[model samples]
Each structure stands twice: as structure tokens, then as C-alpha cells.
Target: MRRVVQFSTGNVGRHSLAAIIGRPDLELVGVHAASDNKVGRDAAELCGLSEPTGVIATDDIDALIALQPDCVVYTALGETRPMEVIEEMAKLLAAGINVVGTSMVWLVTPRQADDWLRAPLEEACAAGNASLYVNGIDPGYSSDSAVFSALSLVTRARSVTVQEIFDYGNYDDYEYTGTAMGFGNSPDDPLPIAFQLGVITSVFGGLVRNIAAQLDVELDEVRERYEPWYTPERIECKMMTVEPGGLAAVRFAAEGVRSGEPVITVEHVNRLTSAAAPDWQVPPEGQLGVHKVIVEGEPRVEVNTLLSHPVLDVTEAGCLSTAARAVNAIDWVCRAPAGLIAADDIPPTEMIRGLMW
Candidate 1:
């Protein structure tokens, strides 16, 4: 069994930690939390597990490292000085401990960025002969596996477009409101628009570019558009914004030019409200959401798939499955060729199997 140390106790963090605790191949050696409220709490209880383990959460990184864990699973958010978290991961790697993280934008495509961000981590991992892999459900699976799955049916395709539509009102994270979904704000607010722009351009930019290259399309321009609106009346929800909902709908469309013409269009959207167009049907109950992939070519076809469970509730079985994907990738990530890797480079079937077991 591989000794593992987990950092953070947030939504994703808690789920990942639970997976680590249950996996026979993995032994949960330590748990770390930045928050004092959670410190000294049982790991299993914190994760809502039935049995209580003696392990108490700590904020001391050095103490956790002193346990000499073989790997560290870092799930801290990117907003809280994410670079610093990456730097610490580098330190752990340099100490000969393999690292797996979902903390930053690196999971999408680390190589695409300027070396200033990617180089140091690479150097540290090499020095310690350790490895790092980062991944998550949305950018990790939906954007890659779901898209690739769609591409399998097409014999010839001029372009591929993938779109995910879901209500953000279900998410339990409060930070998601103003920062991610733009709660309690007017449709014209620049903050929401800016947030959407940064997300699409930063996370999915590489996915779009990679798809273009796979299809042999030369990309000229990639753009993101945002549309936000407020409901004239209020809607009440336990986790989301107040009644009179604030909806921030964003469309991230990228145009890939081949032969001086737009050949490929990739787009994704996030809707903050429950209102769908009059012509469109509302999503069924317990439905996290739907994914549509359209191939534009001769006898153009569109395929729609649904995830039985949405990831809004971290404690749900579906959420565990998603989190386990990232967790099971740890060993492969440790053995992966140095540098940034994309999901297309990794096999999802194998990842899913490993996680399910």
C-alpha cells in the first residue's frame, strides 16, 4: 500500500480524502487543514464516514512531511496563492515524495503556459525523482473523455463542439457565488464577465487548441463571450443566491481556422439560473446535467449524453466516482514522463476502472 497524505478539507478535498482512506492500495497517513475549526477532528468524521479514525487534522506541513508519506494529494483552491501551493508540492517532490494535485490550472495543460510557472515544478520533481499529476471532473473528464468519446463516432469531421449546461444554484460552496457564478449582481457587471473570460481562456484554451491540432486545423482566433441577466422575481434556494436570482450565462466559443476559414468551433456555457428558453425542456430531477457534442460535416450529427448524478453534492456517489478518477491517476502520474500531460494522453477507461475498484 502507498502511504498518502491529504491536504485541505473542502468539498473536493474531503471526497478525495475519503477515497484515499477506503482504497486498499492506499493508506491514509496524514490529513492537513488550513482551517483551525477542522484541526484535531477525526479524518473519517470530517469526511462523514461511519468509523472514526484517530488521525487529527493539522495545519503544519512540515509535521505532515515528517510522517514520510510516499505521496501527497493537494486539493487546495487556486485563488489562495495557488503558486505557493505548487511551490510546496515541488518541495515535497524534491523530498522524494510523489505529488498529485487538483489545486491549479496545471491539470488542464501545464506545458502551454510560460515556463515561469511550469519550469520550477519540473526541475524539483526531476531532482527528487518524483512525479506530479493534476486532474478534476469538469476540466479533467467532461472536457476530455466526453469530447473524445464523441469524436469516436465520426468518420470525418470538420469541427467538434462540446457544451455543458447546468444550474450553479445547487453548488454548496459560497465562494462560488460572487467569484465563479456572479451572485447578487446585475447582468451588466464586469466582474462576472471577467470571471467567465479568465476561466474559459485559462482552462479550456488548451483543450480547444489540442482538438484543433488533432483535426489538423490551424487556429487563428479563440474568443469567449458572456451573457448575464437577472430574474425579475426572486427564487429561493438553500445554497445559491437569494430570490430574484442573478443569472450569469457565459458562452466560450473558440474558432479554429483551417485554410483561412473557420473549421472548428468549441464552446462551453455555465448558467446560474433555472430558467431555460421556452422551446427548451427543463432537465429531469436528480440530473446533474447534459452534454451535447455536435460534429459539423456531411450528414452532420449531434449526440447528447447525461450524467446521472451532478457533482454539486460532494458527498454523493457520483461525486466520489469523479474524485476517484483523479485519485487513481496518482500512480500513473508518478510514472508519467516528466512535464505537463493532457487527459487525451491518458486513457479514461483505464482511469475509470482503477478508480471504481
Candidate 2:
């Protein structure tokens, strides 16, 4: 059995903790808590488990390294703090601990990452002979694994598009939804970080490039486009409130352009509610979210991936899937070579470990 340490107890981290404890092939060793309130708390309490695993959350990285687990499931936020997250993972890699994480979405296609961001981790992995694999739902499997798999069904391929359509009403992080995403802000105001220059490309562009590489196509450029929707009435989400005329929905797309056409595209449709954007894509059957891959060619292929949980809500289940995405890859990453790894690096398999009951 592989011993594991879970890092963070935030939206995604809590689920990672629970997943580690529940997996029979994995042993819950320690948890790295980021907040003072979470430190010293039982791992079970942090993840809503009834029984304690005899593991407590700690803030010390050194302490977690001392435990020397086979792998660390890291779910800390890396969108805003890329450098710090890189350094943190570098430290873990240098300590000889393998890591599978959902943070640092740009690292999903490690080769596309800027040299400065990729170099440190590579050096650390070589130094300790460890591997680092980063993945999540959208940037993780939706665009890379799911897209390529669907293409195999088609006799001839033309162009491919991967989309993430979600209602953000259940996403409770106000700082992210309200401010960083500009959800409750006026459309006339300056665009938020979500649409700022190079942000979408930095996060999702790698998927486009990775797809191009997979198909042996060269992209002349990658272009980005953003569209915003204003709420016709007040809509109150769990985290923030959207007034009339405030930004309610956003559609962002990044396309890999060849001579004159887009060969690969990654798109995101995020809304505060399904009613926010009647013209744009919304979740199917009024559900919370769905990841879609559309391949336009001789034999058209459209695959939709919906994730739901019995006890958790849509947003929580989404976070759970993000955690599961990394946790499922633990065994594969443990045996991989020492370096940054991507979805294409490992063989494509379902890797579902949960019991049917």
C-alpha cells in the first residue's frame, strides 16, 4: 500500500483528505493544513469523516517531509500564487516525495509552461529522483484525455473543441467568483483577472497546444476571446450577490490557429445561474455543470462528461472529482520517471477505485 499525505483543507483539499482515507490501497499518513483553525484538527474532522484516521493536520512542511510518504495529494490554490506553489512543490520534490496535485493548472501541459516556472520543478525532481503530476477536471481530463479519446472514434478528424459549462451559484468562493472572475462587477468596469491579458492562454492555452502536438499539427498562433453577460435582475449566490446590470456570466475561448482556421479550441462558459445567459451554453438538463468535447469531422463525435455525488452538492462533487483526478493517478505517478508529467505521459485508463455500493 502507498502511504499518502494530503495538503490543504480548502474546497478541494478536504475532498482529497477523505479520498485518501477511504482508499484501501492508500494509507493516510499526515495532512498539511494551511490555516490556523485547521492545524491540530483531526483529518477526519477536516473532511467530514465520522471515524478518525489517527492523523492530525499540521502547518509544517518539514513535518510532512519527515513522515516520508510515497505521495502527497496537494490541492492548494495555485492560480493566483503560481510562484509560491511552484516553490512549495519543488520543496516536496526535493525532499524525495512524489506529488499529484490539482493546483497549478498551467502545469497540466508542463512543456507549455514558461521556462522559469518549469525549470525549478524539473531541477527538484532530478535532485530527489521524484515525480510531479498535476491535473484536475477541466484542464486535467476534459481537454486532454477526453478530447483525444473521442477523436479515436472518428474515422477522419477535422477540428476539436473542448468546453466547460457550469453554473457558479454553488461555487462559494466569493473572492474568486466575485472579484477575480468579475461576476458581481459592472461590465463597464475594467475586466477582472479572469479576462486579463494572457490569463486564459496561460491557464488553458496549453491544452490547445497539447492537442495540436498530439495530432502532429503546427499552430501559427493561439488567440483568446471573452464575452460577458449582464444580469437582468438581482441574483444572490451563496457567496456573493449580483445586482441588475452586473456581470452574471462569461464565455472565454482560446483557439489554436493554423493557416486560417482553428484546429483546436478550449472554451469555458461560467455563469452565476442557468438563467444568466439564455443564448450561451448552459449545463444540460439544468444540471450544475458538464465538460464537453466536440469533434467535427467525417464521423462527428460529441462527448459530455457529468459528475455528481450522492451526498455532496454539484460544486462539492466537482471539487471531489478534482481531488479524485489526482488521487487516482497516485500509483501511476509513483512508478513514473523523475520529472513533471502530463495526462499523455501515462496510459489512458478509467482508474476508478470506488466500490459500486
Best TM-score goes to which candidate? 2
lDDT of 2 by residue, 195-235 (tens): 89998888889889989998989999999989999998999
Model 2 steric clash pairs = none
* Alpha-carbon RMSD to native, per candidate: 3.2, 1.5
- As a whole number from 0 to 100, the lDDT of residue 5 in candidate 2 is 95
lDDT of 1 by residue, 116-142 (tens): 667888888788888777766655565
The clash numbers for all candidates, in the given order, read: 5, 0
Best by lDDT: 2
> How well does model 2 score by local distance difference test?
0.88
Runs in model 1 deviating more than 4 A are: 193-199, 243-245, 254-266, 276-286, 298-305, 309-321, 353-357
Model 2 misses residue 228 by how many Å?
0.8
Clashing pairs in 1: 233-244, 234-243, 234-244, 235-243, 235-244
